[model samples]
Target: MKKTIFLFAILLFISCKKEETKNESLYPEAEKSAEEKQLELGQAIFEGKGNCFSCHKPDQKIIGPSIQEIAVMYKEKNGDMVAFLKGKAEPIVDPSQYEVMKTNFAITKNLPEEELKALEAYFYSFAK
Candidate 1:
């Protein structure tokens, strides 16, 4: 009887642990902070609908400045990237690329405010 009770207790402990793990997996977003969620949204926009990845790479300059470069510049200068995307602010990262980026304004200008902020957060994510 003693051995049977010990085994039952062990089994109960294992089941509880499994249940906790399952819950953590099921609601993964619940564990993410607001900033993390914003970054994810920004990444989706940059890679998908925003089409930013075509010109800007994460670490190296392609058709435009790298994300890290932009983030560092903006952080240092206190520039407003979201305002630029909205066409309310001048280009601060690469004025030479302004003409090229203008072509994308039609898409960026139409994004929801939340998405624009998310994109800004994503860019700033690379700031060191």
Candidate 2:
């Protein structure tokens, strides 16, 4: 029984390892889309009126975190990122870091819904 269990575990490890290596090669066209063009508009809001560039960049971390990291957290949380923006959902990634963002959300609270949608799309587009 012990030997069988060890063999099963080894097989599982190898299967999971193979999956990890194949992940990036699985998609190509989705990386660039008309939806991504909208991100350019969203990116402007993020950097300008939203002033998100003060804390975030496309690939780096600042006082908060990167947009890429947010995209990963959004996928893992299994919920709409917009709901989180509306205060309808709790933080699932780096909640300690969220506390810092908490100080700023009130400013974001007044943003128009369309703008919020654009922002959500903008952040998620990084996942592409």
Name the candidate that leads on TM-score: 1
**TM-score of the candidate numbered 2?**
0.65
Candidate 1 lDDT score relative to the true structure: 0.94
Q: In model 1, where is the ten-residue run with the lowest total lDDT?
A: 22-31
Find the candidate with the highest lDDT and give its number: 1
Q: State the lDDT of candidate 2 residue by residue for 27-125, as single tens digits.
A: 744555667657776787898887888988777888778898888778776657667777767887678777777765775677878778888889888
Model 1 steric clash pairs: none
Cα error, residue 84 of model 1, in Å, equals: 0.1
Model 2 spans with C-alpha error above 4 angstroms: 1-37
Per-prediction TM-score, please?
0.80, 0.65
Question: Model 2: C-alpha RMSD to truth?
Answer: 9.5
Question: Model 2, residue 72: what's the lDDT?
Answer: 76
lDDT of each: 0.94, 0.78
